[model samples]
Target: METGIVIGAGIMGTALARHFLKCGHRIALIDPDEAARAAAAAQIGPSEEFITAPTPEALPAAWGPCHFVIEAVPERLELKRQVLGALSRQFGPDTLIASNTSGLRAADLARDMTHPERFAIAHFFNPADLIPAVELVPAPATSPQTMDLWEALLTRSGKKVARLRADLPGFVANRLQHAMARECFHLLEAGVIDAEGLDTLTRYALGVRLALIGPILQRDLNGIDTHHAIARYLYPDLAANTTPAQVLDDKCAAGMLGRKTAQGFYTWDARQERRAQRVEALLPAVIALARQIETEENDDAEMGEQARGL
Candidate 1:
């Protein structure tokens, strides 16, 4: 078991720390505010104990030698650079440095580091304790051994790890999401659909279908030739429009960009946070359903093979 130091006690950071602690690793959570640290720790409950460091400088002294250090601060390049630089100075060359950046390039981040070989991106989805996917993006200078060890550590912590061969902007999920969202904005701007209607369509149609079979698999099952025919018409139209929709442009002009600004596609209310919790609570059951479907399919395949004596 490796000692872990997680910097930033924000929502995602605290959630990840709780998950790691559940896996029985000693964690030192570093945050500047004592009240924030105490609140986050309390939310994590009494089962797991974490040492708190009031600042990044205090982490190494307080936690001793940490094998892994995770930076989950805000999406700022300079802040991440400073934290990683400090950790490199504090720890040995063997220590793994992971940045929980969503869309940032890992190679760009590791450029100024003393030990770039140990730097990698361990991008976790929001509400880390629930989401199973963790993108393990290794920089060009990152050592193969370091990448392998980090992957193994995350797997042991009960996350499904996906290794990206290249450090592209937005990685995988965000790229797909942004592509869809761009079209969504276009539709809304054109008055093709309202927010509630769009949400309903996504929840009922694409969401349920994607949950059962992924895009590629679904295309295969539905006949790729048919997909090609649809794509042929859709692709040209999708590619033709590079301009952002005017409605979004107007919103930006007015300074409303979702929850951060308190308004965008939808108005923000504090109750939405509670609503999100209720939705997240159903994730485990949803995962279990998917697992059950997979198991049954496997069993059916085995029975058919036994019957055929193959």
Candidate 2:
């Protein structure tokens, strides 16, 4: 079994370490914070293949030459660069390094790295263990080998690998998500829809369909010409604001942050628990249906290729 070193003991880091353990990799979880490391160790439980340390230097000498090392620290460019630079020197040249940054560009992160070619972004969504997809982004200096290695590793871990053509900021998933959020916030602020109605529509209508076919495929199914026509009429009316919504700003100013503050767009308490349970129940079912759809599409493509060959 290969070794996987995960730096930072935050939520993403611990979850990723857990996933690596499940994938049968020897894991060395490192965090500078003693308490954070302790918390992660507790969360991950005890395993012979697993070890925790305050830093890579603190770990036992034999953990070197790991297969991969992923940094899941805070989303600061300089901080990430510092961590990665140190790691690049600590590990062997063959050890592929990755960042779990949500938005930072791969190019920026690799600028000062000791081995830029082996570094890339393996952006995992929140609750990494549960998320089935991981975005693989490579910097200009990154080697094709690095990309292939990451794709293979993530695929082996049961994650759908999405390779991007360029190292774009915010990447694919976050850009799409923020675009939707921008529009949603604009609509709410304009009184076009209330908070509850907005969420209801998103949960039932948008979420259900998107999970099955995704956005582009859904557009094709609904007819791109129809979408084009509607866009012509609606584009001008859509939100073009570069700033955060006034409603969201006011809520933040008042310290009414969601869940953490117990209030925001909605009050948290029993509803939060219920919502969490509902999502936990629904997501696995949605993932199952999506997999079935993908298989059918693949079968149809194969048949088309066979027909052409005949």
Candidate 3:
């Protein structure tokens, strides 16, 4: 029912566009490269509504009553600001603007926009369409209406959105993700465990439980006093530095970017990358399992309440 404009035409952008199209919204995909557009088409399929171009300047004149725009360009603070400025000029003040930045603070990205209140961070996880979780970060300058509208819109699109309390660096998920990564790299560098050992233990041990009960609930089940005691004893050994881990920095310097370059902590090739894509397909099942678990818990609580009343 709405016309949505998504700028970038990369993996995230195309995924978003595909979702929008499935929801019966017309989409205009903007990207500067023809090859990028072609690749996107290959992923999402060709459609008249899938308008592609260098910029918003090339948006179809018929894309009327466009209420939402998601800028999904690469993670560069300056580049995002520039693109946002251009979007503000094109769409006027009323149109809702969102950035799919993974780490940049919403306020910093909206600093240059003419109407800062219209901007927010709609940080979709990788493979936006497949990932149900989206971190909704709003700057203090962002309007309350913008927040409400986006929460409703994304929810209607079958997204599980977490509206963060503060628009700090890295948001919520990324901070936790990097916190884990930093420690893993530190341990790897210290020769405490090999990469495969770390990965194997992580998959079979931490990953399975985490997929169901969250860390906070796990702490509650384990007892707070026990957790506090462990934290007191273990905090000193954890990686708590601001600097990038030397192991990670040196790997990037060597251009051993995993999956794409076929080298990193583990070797990768085209076949490996293709196999990894299968992992993404399992997310729907995981989401369903989480939902069912919560529903069963809720039902049990309700039955207990009824029995107590009787």
**Candidate 2 ranges beyond 4 A from true positions:** 297-310
lDDT of 2 by residue, 118-153 (tens): 999999986787778999999999999999999999
lDDT tens digits, residue span 1-310, model 3: 7788899998799999998888778888889999998888788887766677777777657656678999999889999999998888878888899999989998889887888898889999877877778999999899888999999999998888899878899999999999999999889988999998998899899998887888999999999999999999899989887999998789899999787688987788777677787788787787788778878999999999999995
* Per-residue lDDT of candidate 1, residues 277-308 (tens digit): 68889888877776777789999999999999
Q: Over 4 Å off in model 3, which ranges?
A: 297-310
Give the range where candidate 3 is weakest over 10 consecutive residues by summed lDDT. Answer: 56-65
Location of the lowest summed lDDT over 10 successive residues in candidate 2? 276-285
> Each candidate's TM vs. the true structure?
0.88, 0.92, 0.93
For all predictions, the C-alpha RMSD in Å is 3.0, 2.5, 2.3
State how far residue 82 of model 1 sits from its true place (Å): 2.0
